[model samples]
Target: MYLVKIIKLALVSGAIFIGVHAFAQDDNNKAVVMGNFQLDGQYYLEDSAISAVVPEETMALSGFGNILYRKGKFTAGMRFETYLPAPVGYPAGASWSGTGIGYRFAQYSDDLFDITVGNFYEQFGNGMIMRTWEDRGLGVDYMLDGVRLKVRPSDWSEITAIYGKQRFNFDNGTQFVSDDLGQGIVRGINADFDLNSLLDSIVALPGQLSIGGSFVSKFQNNNSARYDFPENVGAGSARLKYNIGGFQFSGEYTWIGENPSAQNAQIVNIPDSLDPSVGLWATGKGVNLNGTYSTRGFGVSITASSLSNMAFQSQREAGAFDSWINYLPPTSVLQTYLLSQLYPYATQPNGEVAYRGDLFYNFKRNTTLGGRYGMKLELSYTQVNSPNIAELNDLGTSRNGAKIDLFDPGDEIYFSDFNAKLTKKFSKKFKGILFYQNIVYNNDVILGAYDYDNVPTKGTVYSDLFVFEGNVKINKKNNIRFEAQALFTNQHLQDWVAGLVEYTVSPHWFFTVIDQWNYGNGDGDDFHFPSVSWGYIKNSSRISVTYGRQRAGVFCVGGICRVVPASNGLSISITSSF
Candidate 1:
């Protein structure tokens, strides 16, 4: 009976495909369909050794699919999402269960203008003043739902405008329009001009030059009982970029009006006073500068930023992962090795002064230092500190926060990292990398979690890490790679070592095994974490499965972070694009 049903389904599918192809051939304007899908599910298990808990549901699943339709100059798309009692550590609240349309939009574009209505994402001026975006790995989505317009008046100039509300949470089976939107309304406009092109008719210049500016505002009803909030908050930014030869320079400055909310309440008012004008309700500002010089095999870059009370959100009461209006890029580089990420840093939005520098050099082959194969060397350093704040009291004796100096670095150091890496190619099929880093992490300031298991982390923790990685191409179809890492620290979790082995059968199959051991615990109760996984890839689809004990730690991507709970589970992931 099953075989007969399968045959019937195949025949019907073939008939439909043939009919569609003939219809397309008959019409000049044929419609095209494209989309992608992904699913992540985990089945938990009880593990006393790792303090892993199995929830009442026993399993958790999250998935989404996007379908897009396009013709000539018009396009439309929608996304379907489901959380079935979201995965552990997911930012999606309890209300995000069941299935619903997460996003939908219709857009039209031509040489003169482009317009979008429904849902969209955008960024302006390094994203310091406004950025509506999402990162699935961090479980953060701030996509705007409304209308976006872009106009190009000339080849050298363009303008963009937006009016929208940010997506907050999904209500099960509700109307897809504004049911899941935030309470505040947002509006913005931006203009960019290419100076070189604009001045070409008047004068001939060197290199390239460009300038842009943006103004964004958010509106929300004032319902606070204790403080008088601004019904409409506004922010503006200006940016400039210049490039000549192999050198590039860019900078942006953003300023926001006085906006007080729950996140900055500590510094919003004096220690015992509530008068809005007496405290740090002063205007906020952010300045970012970047410069890069690259030529041949050597290059260098520098980035510096200063921010003071610059955390802006569409709604004053929104949480950290919701309704965010701006994005502050981090100064530290992202780590690739798993163990190196244990101490990843997050950008501080309230007030911070940060700097980062990087240097890269490559040695030519047939030299004393480069050997028969070429070698590459990389060095980087990053530091972050709190901006100085003055007191608001009469005598200035009490430590009541008042005004902030953006360039002033206070005594407290939030985080810092100094790292170096060397990559060498010993042969055509052999390559190796050696990396080392020294990190200073302030748990009290960074994680805001001072204690673990009744033991305090003692404010600041210092650690040194080393990694050794090698890869070998056994043949045309097979490859193997291995990594060994060690982290030494006296505070927090203490000393640890980890190793990973991965094998790949070229084009389709791969397997990996990894383990971490904490052997320096003071209580003599050491712990070991192990995991294994296998994956297969074909065309545009891939699937993988892993079963192991996961340690409780912080996971971060692009300066944003989320806490991942300890779990012993069988996990599966599938993704496809068509």
Candidate 2:
């Protein structure tokens, strides 16, 4: 392993040299330099009560930095990453060891065309058919390494072409392996047009119109000996957008060829054994539609979407978040409150029908409903249901694994949420917010056995959550804030209460203390989770340190998620940009 690390570092150094030497060849133009830095370190502490464990290493560090240089239309950059034996909760199978250059890229651009070589991120049409991005918070990075070209001949039309391989892991070697599945080749093209811009002289239009389409295909050599899996899978998508004055509408639909992988593979249960293999591949498709209306003091939007057998991966064997060729847009309202998010929703890519709607309003300044600073309020509702499934055989052993329309709402409900928030300013120096929510969730369909148990829980969890928060301005450079929140429930983790308080001193320092207590659990003993943090900020840099117990749960963004383990530790984070 040590030898491998040395080789990777040497190769990375050579690449950097080559890139710099090439840039130096352009002596006429002055180069602009830029850089960024971030670091995070964790010291583990044991708390058996929360199932938190301390590994033998006792400590871990994970950090990265980026350096770049630009001269005219040409530019190049490299990102350095290090992980001294990644922390306990880091994504499994990620090789965050031995200092190495994880990402390096070079690009050149002009008014008509742009070209990039090495590693890059790309997305098409709301990311329904293809997307390659990174979310460090979730430990998800799906960058593609190869070549990309974009062309815009006129103001109304644009085209993009890319040929690359999905990055499975971090290494500068002949071979790479992902925790879920190895490497796979990907090729795609996308085109878009501004219909209004193209037809301005022919006809007058009141609103803008745009259209786009993308086709992406991936190839992975078949590794299974008994089954002839699909070596090449293709997905296509089309989208339309229109905005007229204060009203707007947009929609996207995706079609995926028959491709099955470990994540969404169809499995059947029988009287003799649990069948892990039945259907070799699944026919997949999905759709999303949304509309919004906005005026001076009010706004409203509604969205409906569905995904069925749409787990398209570069490799049929990839599981979890590895090698995802596309992303299913998040269908639920993202809850930001600490307690409100304790039971956040996770997207079901295999088969689900979901809908969400939101409304926001602000009262006039002098009206009774407005108070001193015009009052603001918002309302949101979201619901999701399982996709209608029909068994191919005349038996009840299948796991409801059948092709169905993305718009077909199944009979079984999976989850539902209704929430509202109201904000008001009692005085020039004081402000407050009140929130309420009701959520109904099916554990068996969503979280299964939440406590890491094998036996599934067969019941619905109904919870009503509430929160009251306020902020006070003491003076020019001092302020205070506090929060009180609770969730009333009779199922799953049962009932819980949480409180928080914070103080800030101008543009420099802040401190916070918070506690979440589970007063009602299956076990009689009440568990209280407490944590403290202090932060310092200056210009584009900031630093914070926290010590506390973290609950085990699944965290997600953009429909991708990872399981986080319970942990009690002292953690520090520092960030800066230049």
Question: How much lDDT does each candidate structure score?
Answer: 0.81, 0.80
In angstroms, give how far residue 401 of model 1 lies from its true place: 3.5
Q: Which digits, one per residue and each the tens of the lDDT, describe model 2 over residues 199-255?
A: 989997789999999999988766556456677889899999999999999999899
Quote the positional error of residue 388 for candidate 1 in Å. Answer: 1.2
lDDT of 1 by residue, 199-233 (tens): 99999889999999999999877655655668799
In candidate 1, stretches whose alpha carbon ends up further than 4 angstroms from where it belongs are 1-29, 92-95, 173-182, 266-279, 394-400, 448-456, 523-526
* Overall local distance difference test of candidate 1: 0.81
Steric clashes per prediction:
0, 0
Model 1 per-residue lDDT at 419: 98
